[model samples]
Target chain A: MQALFGQLLVGLINGSFYALLSLGLAIIFGLLNVVNFAHGAQYMMGAFAAWMAATYLGVGYFWALLLVPAAMGLVGVAVERLLLRRLYGLDNLYGLLLTFGLTLIAEGLFHQAYGNSGSTYPVPAALRGGVNLGFMYLPLYRAWVVVVSVVVCAASWFVIERTKLGAYLRAGTENPRLLQAFGVNVPLMFTLTYGFGVALAAFAGVMAAPVYQVTPLMGSSVIMVVFAVVVIGGMGSIAGSIFTGIGIGLVEGLTRYLYPEASSVVVFVVMALVLLVRPAGLFGRQR
Target chain B: MSRIPRVACCLAALLAAPTLAADKVSDGVVKIGVLTDMTGYYSDLAGPGSVLAARMAIEDFGGKVLGKPVQLVSADHQLKADVASNTARKWFDQEQVDVIADLVSSSTAGAVMPVAAEKKRITLLSGPGTTAFTGEKCTAYNVHWTYNNWALANGTGREVVRQGGDTWYFVTADYIFGRSLEEDTTKVVKAAGGKVLGFARHPSPGTTDFSSYLLQAQSSGAKIVGLANAGADTVNCIKQANEFGVTPKQSLAGLLVFITDVHSLGLDTAKGMYLTTAFYWDMNDETRKWSERFFAKHKKMPTMVQAGVYSSVMHYLKAVQAAGTDDADAVMAKMKATPVNDFFAKNARIGPDGLLRHDMYLARVKAPGASKKPWDYYEIVKTIPAAEAFPTVEQQACPLAKSASPAVMKK
Candidate 1:
């Protein structure tokens, strides 16, 4: 039972990253209708930005948490306006290919600058140690990740569902022609939405800095797993993505306790099972 | 008029004579290509450092061979076998590269071997993936200059089990490296009267969570969890193992660990873990001095792979000078006969299967607070001799080993 609880904690931590990255991916897909292949690279950039700010500039984690996401969002805006905007009217496959090329270029540049060896990012002073939970020792930084990710996911959902700007954005996504007819600058909305989604990815990257090293290819490693989560959750619903991310994380954790060999492959197996059960996904509407 | 024409002819002959003499003295420059994974998994081991090591060796040898300047060029194979093979072909055909060094990744090296054979170029393989390249597919041109799975497992697993940590469970990365490492280590464990309770093979490259693997190991009741993986996979497995609280109960033995991995993991998580390697930066005064020099230039400690690159290149240059030709077979014969002396090793030699016979060490990670400085993580426990650390020639299943008369080879 103690081992089981420990696995759950591990699951939650992984789930937090899943929720953050998948939510961002879903948002970009919803607004821009382009699967941003460079999403992982942007996430890696965020971690690198945080590490550089801290190591080179002596900035703390708190400042990096705010600044890294903003910097990445700015980069996203530049990419959307300068590069992605050109492919807007073309086939969506073009966007995917273009973004993949961008991913390669971005990853290559980072590799040129940093090489392949990863740099360490220490956990913050306040959250450096673990707390004894009787059943298992829980690292404070991991708990913090879960709390922050949940809060961020909820806030994003609230803004998208409740706010007037979010309503306009959703309207723009559904019927850009009609939204533009109603004098809502749909193109600008699409650009901002893409920027916001990238920023969310960056935010997760910053959160992940202390847990993992800041590497040139760090994003690519985890991005596929996040994509798997996105697929299992269904690309259609935001809330579904959040729930599925956490749920899968827990299931993965439980498998670690009960069946360790399956832990690494369990998620993909679940993805395949989900596809068989509901091809569109658990939360996706049938096209 | 005849006397004036004779003087003009004499002057033209004098100019042509000097040009012909100069051409005889210097036959252009010798170009060597350093091909390896530049941006993928093995990049830390064989990327920029491998190229830099080769260049440094060339520079140390005065940057000239056969009275001509030497040039070093490199290409990123990106860990793809086909790409590596194709790159080697281009380097040989288009660039006229005489030798190719540091082919990292076993599959990539396997792919590049035939290219080197066909081209008849001297291939000093310091970082090629597996021992099998030298053992089974022993090419006359290819010189396996460093350690392999059998050596690594022999040094770590056999020694560890013999020292009393007997029962084993493997958390293996599901790939060539992991599979080979586990297979080698398991043989050592069983030979030492230890039993493998069970093993779990995790997917390579993309695995982020390792809780399940750790849990299974924990449940198996094995005394040691042998991690037969490298790079981010190894680091992640160890990190998640700590999270799952499996380490204190079951000992974790890393089949392969490098300085870079230690730096990323930090002393806190990695403390008390035992691992084996051919090189450690703080192993000795000589090693420390050499590593300090390298760190000053690259801002990173030299891994065994990087050091292997330096040693292999230096030895290859010497062989080329000795043989008086750049032919693969000639250079390889000279390399085998010659002794390798470097910062990380002394008196190393190429074995029958092309393995570099050198000492391996068992080291334990120190606590973060125990470290006197940053990068001070390991404490050496044992120095494994070259003969014991590597498989015997008889045990080497290479066709070359089988065909060769062991009587004359015994030194």
Candidate 2:
């Protein structure tokens, strides 16, 4: 029983990552109508950015949490203006292909520079150890990850769902020409939205740098699972992805406890079942 | 007069055929292909470094064999069995590669060995530390070099158990190589009068977070958590183990670790761990000399797999020279008959089951304070002799080893 509780807690910690990444995918797909295939590579770049900042400039983790996202957000903005902007009126597949190509290039460049053994990013001195809970020993850093992820997810949710800027943002997605006639800059809004979503991925990357080895391929490993989480929650459903990400995380944790070999495939199994039962997804509107 | 001349011509052609066949280097050149993980998890241990080592061996051997210029080719198998088999098939069938070397992933080695055997080419494996290569899956055209799971399990498992880590639990990678390591270590642990409590098996090649598995191992209350994985996977597990505080309580035995892993983990976290290795670069004068040369090229010290690649390639080239031909059978006979002596091994010889029996070192990771220089992570605990290090020939399940007795081979 204690073991099961411990697995659930660990599952929730992993779910935090899923929630943050899928949330970014959801926001981009919701507003931009383009599936950002390079989000994983961007996330990996985020971790690398943090490691480089620490290694080269002696900037610690706390400063990286603020600076990396802003820096990666600028990169995202440049990508949007230079590359993604031209592909907007074209087919969605073009966007995916371009981003996928970007992913391969980024991954290849990093792989050449750092062979896949990966570099180490030490946990900060403040949150280095764990507290002995009755059921498990929970690292303080993990608890911080969960708390911060929930706060970020909730704050982003409130901004997009409740604010007037969000209303204009959603209005642009509905009809860009209509919103443009109303004295709104729709194109610029989309660029910032993409940048903001990318920054979110970078934020998760900074959080992840301490826990996992900062490697070029780390983003690719979890990107597929995060996509499954987004699909299960319905593509663009903000709250749905957050809840489903955590829910799938718990289920994956339980599977690891029961049958560890099948844990990796468990998320896809759920997606298969969910799609079969509801082709539009649980939270998706019937388009 | 025409019939007499034709008979004389036929006799003269027949006499020249024997001389022509004596020094037949295939395709007028000898090519060696290194099929390894060039971009994946195992790339650090055996990818580009293996290629450099093979090239160094060729250069050291005067870059010629049997009056033919030696050549080298390499491809990334991507750690997929199908990719490995297809590349091996192409190299043997079309490229005229005399031997394939450095198959790091176990599944890749398993896939390519049959193709090499079918095409009558030799394979010198410096990575892929699974004993099944010499046991049920042994091939006549293959030589299992560097190390194997049995030697690792015996070297680290028995030593830890004797030091009072009796109860064991494993966090294993769910693959053939990982499962074999776990099973071999379990036998060693039980043989040393230790009881295994339980285990948790995780998926391979993609698992980034080991917290869930480590939690399970922690709750089992076993005295030791044996990590039955290698390369990056082992490095990740050890890092998370320290974070979760599982290290100070239940010690970890890295069943299959490489120098790259220790270098990645650094001494602060990886200190005080026990592992078994086939070779260490800083062991002595000869090893240091060769490894320093390798370091100048690779920009890092050579792992055992890389060193073994150089040794095996040099030995293969010498055997080819001795036999005066690149024929697979003749070279195999020469390699098996001659004892191997180099900086990597003093006097190791290939057994009938295709395993190269050499002494393994039991090493403990040096603490940060104890480590005086970079890459000086391991303090050699003991030198395990070749006899006790590997499985005896009679114990292996290869059909070719049916007639051989349990005796050590010496030059």
Candidate 3:
């Protein structure tokens, strides 16, 4: 019974990562309508950037959390302007293919530089240890991750769903020519949305560096699961992606206790079932 | 007419001798292929480093064997059984690779071994640790070097159990290699009168988070949590164990760990853990000399798998040279008869079951304060001799051992 609670909490922690990453995918798809295949690679760069900062520049984890996301967001903007922008006028598959190619190139370069064994990033001094919760020993850092993830999700939701700038952004996505006539730069809005989405992924990566081995392949490992989250949550449903990500984490945790062997595939099984029953996803609306 | 007949006889003898020598080397160039996981979980332990080790062996062997120039080729098996088998088949059928080495993943090795056996080519396995390679699946044309599950189980399990970690829980990787390791360690733990409280089997090759599994082990209240995994999996389990505060309360028994894992984890988190290995680079003067050279080239110390690659390759090349042929049967006999004396193993002999019975070391990870230099990780606890470390012929389940007569099995 205690083990179940512990697993559930661990699941929530994992869900936080899913929630952050899928939220980015959801926002990008909602605004830009292109699946960011390189989101995983971008997340990996976030983790690597944190490690490199600490190793080479003597910057600590807190400073990295502040800097890496902004830096990666700028990278996202450049990618949007230089490469992703060209694909905007083409089919969505073109953008996916280009991003996928970029992912491979980035992963290959990192792999060559750092072998697959990977490097370790120490947990911050402030949140280094765990508290003895009656049900389990919960690491303070994990609790921090869940709390911060929820806050970020809520803040982003407030900004996008209930703000004037967000209204302009949604209008730009819905009717770009109309918004352009209103004297707004629609393409720049698209670029910033992509950048902000990428920044969210980097934030998750920085949070994850202390927990997981900062390996070149870390992003790909979780990216597929996050994609499953996005699909199950409905491609562009922000709240749906956030809730579904955490819910799947809970279900995956329960599966770990009930049937450990199927834990890895249980998410996919749910995704398949969801797809069969609701092709547009539970929260997704038909075009 | 008599002088003409004698001249013709000499001419036939001279031609036949050259033909026989040429036939000794089948393709006129001895080729060795290293089929390994080039960019997966086990790559650091046995990927390019294993290739470098094979190259070093070839160089040390004067780059020639049985009067034929030796060549090397390598491919990434990608840790897939089908990929490994296909590559092995291609290497054997077309490339004329006489021996395949450094099959790191158990499934890949299992897949390739049969293909090698069918093609009648030698396989020198230095990476995979499944005991089945020398037991039920033993092939006449292969050698299982480095270490196996049984040796690791006996060395680490027995020691941990003796130290009052008598109640255990296992967090095992779900794969052939991981399953065999858990099974073997369970036996050793039970033999030492330890109780296995429970185990949580996690998916392998790409399990990033092990906190759930560690939580299960923690709640089980076992004195020790045996990690029946390797490479990154083991490292992650230990790391998370620290994060969840499971380590100081309940100890961990790493059934199969490489030096690279400890290096990756660093001494701070990996300190005071007990594990077993086939070789350590800082063991002796000779080991230091060879390993220094290896480190100079590899930029990191060689793992047991990498060290085993060099030893096994050198031994195989020598057997080919001594037998005067690359024929599988003759080389196997010679390799079995010869003793492997190298930095990796001291005077170890290949058993009839194709297992190189070598001494395994039980080492504890040195604490951060104790480690004075880079890669100085292990504090050697004890040496389990080859005779006691490996299974005897009577104990092994290989049919070859059962069928071979006492005269042939005699060492």
Candidate 4:
């Protein structure tokens, strides 16, 4: 039972990364009609940004937590305005390919700069150890990650679902020309939405630095799984991506508990099952 | 650099090296391509660091061999076997790269050695650990430099079993390299009269979360947990093991570890762990000198793989100088005839099977306070003799070594 509870905690922590990353992907895909393939690279960059802060500038985790995302958001906006904005009228596949190319270039540059064995970002002093829950040791940092992830995910969903800004954003997504006639700057909305989505990815990467080693490939490693989560949840549904991400994370943890060998592929297996059961996804709108 | 005229150099090299097409490169130059994982998991151990070591070797060797300027180049294999095989092909076919050095991961090395042999070019592997390199996959133009699975398993696994932490459970990265590591270490455990409890194989190379895997290993009651992975995989496993409180009870046998891994993992999590390695930067004055140069460039102390690159490239250049020819077979013959005593390996010998015999160290990670300074990680507990560290020639039964003496052949 102790072992089981421990696995559950692991599941929740793993779920947080999946949920956060998928949420960002869902938002960008919904608004831009372009799959942000560089989400993973942006995530990895976030960690590297934090690592650079701590290593060179003596910036600690708290400052990195607040500052790294904002910095990466600027990077995100630059990418959108300079490159992605040009590809807006092309096929969505072109956007995927371009972002994918950007991912490769970014990852390659990072690899040259910081060879891939990765460095440790020490868990901040405040969240150092864990709580003995009588059944198992519950790591304080992991619990914090889960709590913070839920709050961020909820905040993102609430803003997108209930705010007037969200209404303009949604209207722009539906028909940019129509939204523009209402004096809305649809292009600015697209740019900010893309930046906001990228910031979320950076936030997740910052959170993951201490949990997972900060390797350039960390984003590529998890991005595939996040895509699987998005596909299973529905490509454009905010709640769907969030819920599915955590659910898959738990299922993976359970698989690890039940059979360690199957843990890696269990998420994909669940994806296949979901695809078979609901071709449109659990929350996807009927095409 | 080369005193010879361009046209004359092409005809001369082409006559002596028929394997390379005459039109490849006309200049009297020896191009050595350092193929390694430049952008992936194994990069830290052998990427730019390995390239720097190769360059240092060439520079130290007077930058010329047989009146030909030595040119060094490199490419990132990205940890893909197909990518490595293609790069090796292109280097051999078009680039006129005479020798390739530092094939890091076993998969990349395995994919490349056959290509090198087929092309009649020499390859020096500085980081691969699969025993198949010295046995089934042995090639006339290939040398498994520094260490392999046999050395790591015996050096670390035997020491762990000897310490009475015998019963073993393996948390392996599921793949060719990881499987081979676990299999080799398992043999060492059983040979030491230790019991093999069970194992849990995790995702290969890319796995980040290891908590569930650690929980299973912790609950299994194994006295010692063997980590059959390298680079980032190994570092993450050890770190997560500490977080789950698994390390306090059962010792971890780091089946494959490098000094850089300890630097990333930090001594707090890696302390007291037993590992086997070919070189540690602080091993001696010679090692320290070379490592300092590497550190100046890489901003971190060298891993054994990087050190191995220096020694192997140095030796390869020496063999070329001795033979007075860049012919693959001739250089290989001179290499086999020579003995290696360098900053990394002490009196190391290349076997007929293409495996190099060198002293392997049994070391324990230093506690936080015990460490003298940054990168001072290991306390060498024992030096496993070269003879016992690698598999015997007879046991390997490499076709190339079938006629050679079973004993260590010293020049």
Give the number of the best model, judged by TM-score.
2
lDDT of 1 by residue, A164-226 (tens): 988987787687899899998888888898899899999999998877767888899888877
TM-score of each: 0.85, 0.97, 0.96, 0.91
Q: Local error of candidate 3 at A80, Å? A: 1.7
Q: Write the per-residue lDDT of candidate 4 for residues B208-229, one digit (tens) a residue.
A: 8888888778888899989998
Candidate 3 residues lying further than 4 Å off, grouped into runs, are B1-23
Candidate 1 ranges with C-alpha deviation above 4 Å: A1-13, A56-67, A123-148, A185-188, A228-236, A243-287, B1-30, B93-95, B282-293, B366-378, B405-411
Candidate 4: clashing pairs of residues:
none
lDDT, residue B339, model 2:
89
Q: What is the TM-score of chain B alone in each candidate?
A: 0.89, 0.95, 0.95, 0.92
What's each prediction's clash count? 3, 0, 0, 0
TM-score on B-chain, cand. 1: 0.89
- Complex DockQ per candidate: 0.35, 0.86, 0.83, 0.62
Comparing only chain A of model 3 with the true chain A, what is the TM-score? 0.98
Interface RMSD of each: 3.1, 0.8, 0.8, 1.4
The best-first sequence of candidates by DockQ reads 2, 3, 4, 1
Question: What local lDDT score does residue A64 receive in model 1, on the 0 to 100 scale?
Answer: 93
Q: What's the lDDT for residue A81 in model 4?
A: 96
List residue ranges in candidate 4 displaced over 4 A: A1-9, A56-60, A132-136, A272-279, B1-28, B405-411
